[model samples]
Target: MNEITSHQCNLNIWAHLPDKVWNRVANIYELMPGWIGYIDGIPHWFGQEEDDVYIQASVEPSGLSFYAQMNQSDWDSWIGAFKLEATKVLGFEVGEPEDGFE
Candidate 1:
């Protein structure tokens, strides 16, 4: 048997954004690779395995956070791209709250 480890990251996006705005975000998710649609209202992604690196949009007190479990390089690239697209499309800065995105 073997053990697998995963990394995680989050994006501090407000969960209460208007439907119109969320609709735009949905469009962005649609274009992203490995998007598996919303499962139980949370966006899900196909990982390397049934239990490997993956991504999920989870609603938390702070906001709609992105929980990603992938290699550092891939996570970095994917999150960067997502942040760029989200910032451009949403017309607001999208980033980790810890990064000063309050």
Candidate 2:
């Protein structure tokens, strides 16, 4: 059976951005061509219904909180894009996603 794995982190840099910027960053995945909306608010890709991959994020006082369950390739792609988007939109250097959760 497929097991759901998770990773969480504090995106401290995100705390400094304005609401508009934050919204833009948060919606990056949603704007992508393959993203599909789910009531659960977890991030996922279209045509991936048969896979167990999933992701979710939220704004926190320190920064942003991100969680995802996916394979290595998916995690690398998704997390890389997320960092890139955050850096581009926020106009700052985003840090690497620390392995595991705090």
Candidate 3:
């Protein structure tokens, strides 16, 4: 048997963001590649199954968190693109708290 590892990161956005802000975020997700759909208000990508190599986003107390079963290079590129889009669309910089976002 083999073990699978999941990589995770958080963006510096509030969990209880306004509906309008969430709507904009949803639009950004929809425009991105591999966006399957939202399940239970969480955005999923590639596939929505447990065994799939996919990306999932959830609202957490600290911020919006992303979990993925993907290669490090791919994950970096995807997350970087998301941050770029978010910064452009949301009118503010979006990044991890550890990355000096705030």
Candidate 4:
């Protein structure tokens, strides 16, 4: 969707992590390249950055959160790639995170 357009769908990707992993989660995003500064103060990854879709990511206590506005197919590909990367960087299985879209 265009930046100016209101998001019709909301997507959330969340996972509970270990205590140690919690502290490092924020750094992962910080060190990663190609992300929009913020969308209303939320760290964001523009669709243009990877695939024509927008994604927002943040870290919570023992959890990782990702918000986005995009179609199912795009979300699947995007999140799938994220899991793989997280597994490599975090050194864990990085199993499928819980997801919701509407």
lDDT of 1 by residue, 1-83 (tens): 12334655566677777898888888888778788887767787765236677888766777767776776677677778888
Residue 2 lDDT (model 2) = 39
Which lDDT tens digits does candidate 2 get at residues 48-98? 435566666666675677666665666667667777776787676676335
lDDT of 4 by residue, 1-102 (tens): 324322322212234546566456555565554565665666776654345567776555334556666666666666666666666777766653343221
Give the Cα lDDT of each candidate: 0.75, 0.61, 0.84, 0.55
Q: Native-vs-model 2 lDDT?
A: 0.61
TM-score of each: 0.81, 0.63, 0.87, 0.52
For model 3, give the 10-residue run with minimal summed lDDT: 1-10
* Pairs with steric clashes in candidate 2: 43-55
Better structure of 3 and 4 per TM-score: 3
* Cα RMSD, each candidate: 3.3, 4.9, 3.0, 6.7
* lDDT per residue as tens, model 3, 1-102: 233457899898786778889889989999887898988878998766575478999888879899988767777778889999999998899999988885
Question: Could you give me the TM-score of model 1 versus the true structure?
Answer: 0.81
- The parts of candidate 3 lying over 4 Å away from their true place are 1-5
| Candidate 4 to truth, TM | 0.52
Better-scoring candidate (TM-score), 2 or 4? 2
